[model samples]
Target: MPRLCGRRGNIRRLTRNSQLVQNRWLNRSAEDQLTDNENLRNQIAITRTNESQEQRNERHRVNTLRQRLARQRVTDTL
Candidate 1:
């Protein structure tokens, strides 16, 4: 009885969902939705890869500078 009453509650009434849910919800065209999901996943993967590459480049630059400074000190002491 409680479960039946709960189903009749005002909050249970359907309303227009927010934009994101509207876009990504299961009821839309399956092919288009899948494509959108794939594109989003690919973008995130590319972003992570680019971020990793940038960190690698920064680390390489720092190492190169450290090596050059060390060589200069050694040459000066000779």
Candidate 2:
């Protein structure tokens, strides 16, 4: 009887090689996602740090003023 042992060996080797390639791809994708998450967190922290109470109040005040002016303009147009 002819041995089919070589075919089995080739199949095992191919499976192992495919698994290794898939694992590497997944690891790289996970690493990139982690880096992106860290960057977003850092940006959020910076934005929070930059918005002090005084600046927030000023921004709110400006927005309110603009809204009032817009209403006035619409009334004038009508």
Candidate 3:
């Protein structure tokens, strides 16, 4: 009877420890997922800003080229 009781106690302790480890792992997983989501959001924002800047640069280049062509046409007519 004493040995049987000791075995039961050991099983209970093992079960409790396993539960604690599982809880810790779950909490860490949630935290890591949240961090990953935030980082992805930041990356998307940066990409949008970079795209906006690139579009503006392209527009400026096109306008400059158009102006240069107009000037060349005028010089040719003269």
Best by lDDT: 2
Q: Each prediction's Cα RMSD?
A: 18.1, 19.5, 24.5
Mind giving the per-residue lDDT tens digits that candidate 1 earns over 1-78?
564554466464554565557556757787887899999999988876778767878978999999999999999999
- In terms of TM-score, the best-performing candidate is 2
Task: List clashing residue pairs in candidate 3.
Answer: none
What's the CA error at residue 51 for candidate 2, in Å?
0.7
List residue ranges in candidate 1 displaced over 4 A: 1-51
Please give the lDDT score at residue 36 for candidate 2.
82
Candidate 1, residue 33: the lDDT equals 79
Q: What is the lDDT of residue 12 in candidate 3?
A: 59
> What TM value does model 1 have?
0.35
Candidate 1 lDDT for residue 67: 100
- List runs of model 2 lying over 4 Å from the truth: 1-49
TM-score each candidate. Answer: 0.35, 0.39, 0.35
Error of 3 at 33 (Å): 55
- Model 3: per-residue Cα lDDT over 24-76, one tens digit each: 76778767889988999999888767787778789789999999999999999
Ranking by lDDT: 2, 3, 1
Clashing pairs in 1: none
